[model samples]
Target: MTDLPAATAASSRPDGRASPGLRARLPFLIPLVVLAVVAAYFYVGLGRDPHVVPSVLINQPVPELALAPILGRDRGLTTADLKGEVSLLNVFGSWCVACRVEHPLLMAVAGQDLVPIHGVNWREPTPQAGPAWLARLGDPYTLVGADPDSRAAIALGVSGAPETFVIDRAGVIRYKHTGPITADDWERTLWPIIQKLRAE
Candidate 1:
């Protein structure tokens, strides 16, 4: 008689389901690792200000500017234009919402006659857009130029629209303010810097 096969041991649980092994558990661990990485990334990022970016152009002489005036305007902006006073060189664009947000404050600054504000209208799809937006917002710039190709903007180390530089009387860039200038930024920080520069 053939020997009866010894009863095989059950690999599965009494419930008839296979026991989960390391391979089965690995997939669950992957998401926890990913989540941990993401959470740590945000935790580090939360401590830094997004607007305080580094620039190679800070404290450097103003780059050469031969940009033409925006549409419907006569004088263009030149490096010569930035000399002989404390001024704001604001790089902006009509399409940039942040520029619009900062315009009223600029208008107020212009209204006060505190400093000469110059503008670089950056990368407009149509030349008319800059002129039109300025007309609606009311031009605060003493001199406004078109930077359709971003030559001047790149030289100025511009990362985005609505970047304002505080230039000293000698055509030197003293301070660079990235992003829109709020009332507090103007009053508490920039205005004081300008006052100090003006005294010098």
Candidate 2:
């Protein structure tokens, strides 16, 4: 009592607890550092190109694709149909706005008869929904199939509508495009890949 230690005097509160201000072990700082690290990680991630979607289907044989034809189409799609020619199999839905965005490009591809363009009408609300949408927009598919329950879509590893697969003449899946195709995409990437596949 006559002499309280100077170090203890400076560090203790009036109630005899160690003063938080004097303690370098700041319990409050852990969360702040964690928050800062998380923010930095997200900020760095934002700079990456979002269009790159990986698929296990690349270089693998196309999945079993027996599906009913969309309304007004004569024939359904089958795995055997995919063989004997290089083709583009587009997975689309009537409800997908992105498919609409990419439709004109597909129409152009079909109009030019560049190659066989097949359609997998994925997860349509009704059988007629795909047919009606195609009728209004103009059908561009060599063969169109309906996949209301996403059976074929899941086998093809489709994450969303407007995904396109580049299939080799042997019915192997060579490439998978995830989003709506632009003219630049066709010219720069898709067409080049198709041409290369055609050679092999």
Candidate 3:
């Protein structure tokens, strides 16, 4: 039988070399590259201070607040009550462990008579529980406003319990501090800001 022409051998590229098809699709990878960069940025940001949630309400007017009195309290609190002087508006709850953690510091601050400490009692199981908890823990607030529905808390942009806002004399929000305020946080950060706001 006549010999057939030698079969052509398939050419193979070197190892680690990409095929032309893959090279042609390189432009499709741009979006993935951008997504990876964005993901990396957020991952890095996650290591930052857990208590620092940047507030959009800073330097803005405090939201209109007219809340009913907490149970057993003679009077409720309002934004109007906060207008004449610099005050601390604290969002707290009976159920919040952090609120319990910060309670003593708040008492200390209240004892100093530096600023009037107002309360937004947020998401309590029963309205009376707030007053009861305060009665047991020693009430540190000048006035307590019941926010059982959390509508007022939402207006203030509260993420959770134990957040504090420093309001200026004109009822503008000057600063917001998330998480339970520690003694160091009070002495170093919050007290200074409150003093500065009072001076303004």
Local accuracy of candidate 3 as per-residue lDDT tens digits, 69-185: 988888998879989999999999999999999999899888888789999999999867888999999999999889989899999988888899999999999989899999898
- lDDT scores of the candidates, listed in order: 0.91, 0.91, 0.88
| TM-score for each candidate, following the candidate numbering | 0.77, 0.77, 0.77
Model 2 CA lDDT for position 20: 65
The residue ranges of model 3 lying beyond 4 angstroms of the native Cα positions read 1-43, 49-52
Among all windows of 10 consecutive residues in model 2, the one with the lowest summed lDDT is: 18-27
For lDDT, candidate 2 versus 3, the one ahead is: 2
Q: State the lDDT of candidate 2 residue by residue for 21-95, as single tens digits.
A: 725667778899999999999999899766665998899999888999888878999999999989999999989
* Candidate 1 local lDDT, 38-119, one digit each (tens): 9999999999888677887878999999999887888999999999999999999999999999999999999999999999
lDDT of 3 at 63: 95
lDDT of 2 at 65: 80
Q: Give me the runs in candidate 1 sitting further than 4 Å from their true place.
A: 1-44
Task: State the TM-score for model 2.
Answer: 0.77
- For residue 130, give model 3's deviation from the true position in Å: 0.5
Model 1 / residue 109 / CA error / Å: 0.3
Candidate 2 residues lying further than 4 Å off, grouped into runs, are 1-44, 49-52
